[model samples]
Target: MGIYGALSTAVTGLRAQSFALENVSGNIANSQTIGFKRIDTDFVDLIPDAAPKRQTSGSVLAQAHSTNNVQGDVKGAATETYMAINGNGFFVVEPRAGQADGSATFSGANFYTRRGDFELDKSGYLVNGAGYYLKGLPIDAATQNISGSVPQVLQVSNAFLPAQQTTRVNYELNLPQLPKTPKYQASQSSGSELLSATDFMTLTPDQAATTTGAATTAGAATSSLASAGETLTIQIGATSRTYTFNSGGSTTMPAIDISDTSTDTIGEVLAAIQADLVTAGATGATVGLDGTGKIAITAGNATDTITVTDGTSGTSATGFNLANGTTDPTVATSTALAARVATVTADQTDDFLNQSVSGGAITVYSSNGAPAQIQMRWAKVNSTENGGAERWNLFVLTNGNATGSGTAWTRMGGDYTFGADGSPSPAIDHTDLPNLTVNGVLVGDIRLQHGAHGLTQFADPNGTAEVTTIKQNGYPAGEFVSVAVNDSGRVVVSYNNGQQLEVAQVVTANFNAVNQLKRMDGGLFAATSESGEPILDNGGGVIGSSLEASNTDISEEFTKLIVTQQAYAAGTKIVSTADEMLQQALNMLR
Candidate 1:
């Protein structure tokens, strides 16, 4: 019985070694396989007795252990869809059981694998080298997000991709501290007139209360004041005073006499009237010309008034007429009221070639595959008003006239204001554009965002709008060009319209005890009770345009092969020696 037990043990050893040799052979054969996880032979002893002392040489049992978590070399590949996992996870896949004319059917049971040499099949299914279909979370077209938790078979469409409208734009620019044309200056009323109602009027109560105040003012003309002999009469605080201008050294003044029809220098006549008023005991009565060369008269007292007809003998022929009033009125200072400039007309606005500083143009698309050029213009607003406030008014041209001779430019929300520093302020972080509809077409509202460090106000001698960044989210309809997997484990499809869309997110599965998984055909694993349940993982990113090579090493497998061959040979020798011993015993019995 002992002899036969020895032979049986040797036979078990031979079987175990043969199993190990088979594992080695498999590893060696699949050394060039893509994403292949090598399997190693595990041996266990089956003892005849439970007690250690009584136990005989036990038989060896062979079990398979998988090196699933071992990483393989990810290499570049020509195929776009070929991807490799960089970390610990397997791509969720399903084996096709049935195939019809246009589609294939799956058994609904998920299988995990590392082989990712995938390509699009006839029905748009992503089939790998092992004929396994890849599964991933589908992205909703409307929301552009993963829809459900359960992953489904990912499909690629060969049809044309629809267009997307521009909803948001990013912009960063530096406004130079340059000069700008004053709109208020063009709108202000001009001041120039002869002595009449246009220049003189009844002073207001508040103005009258001030003893020394301007009655009226006008712009200077090349001509001088009325003739030197003109007698100008002014009522100061109820006392009418008359001053006569001498013809000596022709001079000009604010008020000339009604009798004088010939003109003279205003300066000389004003000095003569001032002398006369002082002599009449009305020293406070003053007459002067402002910076704009407008004549102004001040009464001696608060209640003093300068009625043009006070001392005149009702002579309308030559006397300074007060009944007829002038439109321009004199103020304390020379600075006059400026006009408000809101919208620019064709004449006020500038053309693309002339007015714009430095700007860039971008092409955006509408929903119906309509391509429109978005022209940007940075018109200097005010460099002198706000103490060197570097401000630029942005304008958008949507199929607008390039000449800007018409009202084709639509102004963007606010002026791009830049401070002294080279950074932009958060106060003008984002501006909402006006045109919901462009060129009679309905597009969504576009919002432009400027980062904190995006804009600058430095004095750029070039006077061009130095744009730092510009981008928009919009594309026209495009035909399918290619598809690839990104590093984030997402399926991105490219189009002929120079656009890329993330269609689906690849899903991965991991297990706590990977060795316990049951091995399947084509380097696959099935979850079992011994192996923990599959846990969904996204940490392992995908390498695009690459394939994972087999983890098996030929040299290691050959080394194990040599050991397995020697062990099998030793087991055969033990069995032969045990057979000879049994034969000898039988011969003695004979």
Candidate 2:
């Protein structure tokens, strides 16, 4: 019986030694394995027989011994703590699939894991080397809001992709200040007055000279007493002309008869006078009979004279008047000519060259070489139905006169209809207007708008319509420049604005009882039923800019290794001692 007892004890010792040796070998083999926990073996003593002590009281027991069985301790492999996750979440894990849905769904069940080593696949999904995707809630592309709940299985190959670069840019500029033209005034009257020539007259003489005392024709002066003076007689008529002079110096004419045939008519006499005037070198003279039948002559010079004569007869009498008219007005006089008032029609095609709405003035430049001026008074209004409205007035001015005023600019053109709801359609084609020119150069102003929410402005001097694109240069294609994380645990990748999206995110997983996690060869754990569902959190939260290092502590592992080796050695010694005792008992039995 002693021999059998010794042999049974030795068998137990050997089993214990083998278990301890296996644990030591596992510890050493997986020293470099990630998440590996060291194992240990334990022993328990067998109870002595209580019935014998009660039944045979006071009888000395020949052999009092206890049997033991080897039992291994199944402690949690390691005491290392997970550095991340305190508050509201767990690291989410995704499954790898041969094919993935566009909506990021998976056909196989999602298996939670603690492996965070991740990189981006060529398709931009956050993936591990095995191509498993990390899962999270879907987000809207434009608004960037979470769209839906996280799917049960997030495939690594189906993660959401972000835009590579900016799509547009916006700009606004402040308009330059300008002077305002006055309004047109129509009631003012303003204008100036200029001097013009009308007629001329002429004069003429009748005879040379005449003597009072003359001799009678044909008969000698019959001793008419020439008292102290010689008496002369002259014949002075046509038919039988004669003149007698008395001694007292008085003249008497003989009874001479003028022949009717020798007398000239008024017409003939006028013709003769005109002929004599022309022969005497008179110019600009007219001869005519007035109401009294007397011949009158008008000439350019006041002091000139005219002589007349018949063709075959003696000299005829000539008479006239002479005068000159005033000078004519000069042709080069200057009067108040009205200034040219140009009229231009406003068109929809006019470019919004320069629109300045500041300092109570609005100046709009048109293609007609002048800027239209409007005085604006802006008012703010609140309305739920309609957005808002602004009133404007256009003024016309010319030479300090306001020709037109208070014209409403309700719309850019009549074709543009404004809705009562305060929304306006695209009515005006601004590009059609000539380029806004300042000092003969094209320029524009920045435009700004304010709403109930906030204010935004653009700096678009070149008038570029689209305002969103951002371009980056001088970077390598695959180099990573920056990284960012959002509120939803999704990691964003930046690659010098170039080709590479190195790694979107590194997915994490959690468990209910992390101690129950099955350790894999690497420092990773496979999920089991004891571990709860993974709570997904973003990389932005507690794990920002941080990396999870291996949990193996070299000092503690070395200590555990030494303890395991000693325990194995002790178990071997127990087996050897039990074998020797059995051999001794067997020899005594022999």
Candidate 3:
């Protein structure tokens, strides 16, 4: 190659250096742009075909090199809808084609972008700062699940959310073993801490079962006293009365004598005993013998208990087959027929309130968006310490202010019994409240779900129920308030009714050869043969309330700028020298 050839090569060098300088200038200009990827220039040399030793570099060419795969610095942003990718990904987007019928139209073609400064437009479309619309999978509000895998341009509106009826309530709580209720005192008996079953009974009177002694000879009341001066004692509550049998004395003599074995028959002896009980202020007490001549005794009131004892001197009480101790005629057990009334009558409302402890309350919505607050209470019907299995009953107040003859509360039917391990005996995971009506609003049947081992009967020193989790799957109708993106790439929308729902799923698109994508305006990219098809839902995590800064480094671009300037000047110097040599050759020829 001669001087002319050198001039042509110099020209190519200048072109390449100019291209490099242009790239550096562009990088420096967009150094602060959001989600900007800087471009670099690559030089390729052209060689002439010749023998191995004779081959020479002929020309130079400049080509644009992409830095699309490089990551930008992510920083927090003020906008809630703005997002940034932590690694490798692009947000699926599309440009608006045109407006028709006063509505924004979208081009069916999909474009990928890193600019996530998105906001809700007037038409309810999520558009970015560059006017590109975001694409995502619509989610079912009721089921809270993504509709499909295919993404479309999302348009979220501020429409009112319809009310949902309450179907189920998730509940998990711990019940105290020994509830220290208001009616319980340390000086009281061990079972006093539990609810009084008699106070809420409506079917039958809470009467103790009659206690019968061993059978004796029929109508043969003759000298079984083992001698005179034999005494028998019957005590009710704090009052005690004694009966002494005297020879030849009337069955009602001595004001405390019940019978004489020589003269009084068994019926007369029992009658005298009943009279003595009336005189001793045991008003409702009864003393009698069954048809088989067995001595039977009954207590007066529900609260009063009876204790019978034999005298030390004589076998008079023993002759009647009565032992020394408290009689079996005691208050009815909680499981008795009367204490199992399912509904709390108005007359028993006060007693019900005093027996049961608060079990928390929650407001639920009806199908028509009507709101009703449900109040719950837990009653300990039986305890292990009281010679019964640990059992409980849950009740809901129907009418707090109900008076005589009206229903006040209704029991959610179940004998919630617990085993020794503090877990439900049969594992009660759920129950239902049938047509629960509070105050006057009727709430349909709702399933009360208690997860595995959700209800516990532990020893709580405070003697209060601890509700760990209580939430219902229903809400009143609400107006939309705002929207936000989460780190999990879900679009969450908030409402005025204190409801937050996942309305859409924002998926990321990735490519095999991301650097080979065709760059477009507004930080967007189009797929190319070399870039491969868009692979979705497999990209890096999305960071919400943040933005990705430009990948261009100002200092590096400035350095390249200086180097390109020097190279361009050197190329110009080579052209000047080549022209001077041509002039020298012409002068020599002259």
The lDDT, on a scale of 0 to 1, for candidate 3 is 0.79
Residue 355 in model 1: lDDT: 45
* Candidate 3 segments whose C-alpha is farther than 4 A from its true place: 202-335, 344-351, 403-405
Worst 10 residues of 3 by lDDT: 328-337
TM-scores, one per candidate: 0.69, 0.38, 0.80
Clashes of each: 21, 50, 0
**Position 452, candidate 2: lDDT:** 25
Candidate numbers sorted by lDDT from highest down: 3, 1, 2
| Candidate with more favorable, higher TM-score: 2 or 3 | 3
Residue 204 shift from truth in candidate 1, angstroms: 26
lDDT of candidate 2 at residue 280, scale 0 to 100: 47
In candidate 3, list every pair of residues with a backbone clash: none
Tens digit per residue, CA lDDT, model 2, 399-494: 122123321222111111122332223322221112323223222231222122121122323322221212211122234444444333455444
Best model number under lDDT: 3
The local distance difference test score of model 2 is 0.32
lDDT of 3 by residue, 313-386 (tens): 33444465564554222222332322454778888876777777788898888887798888888988777676
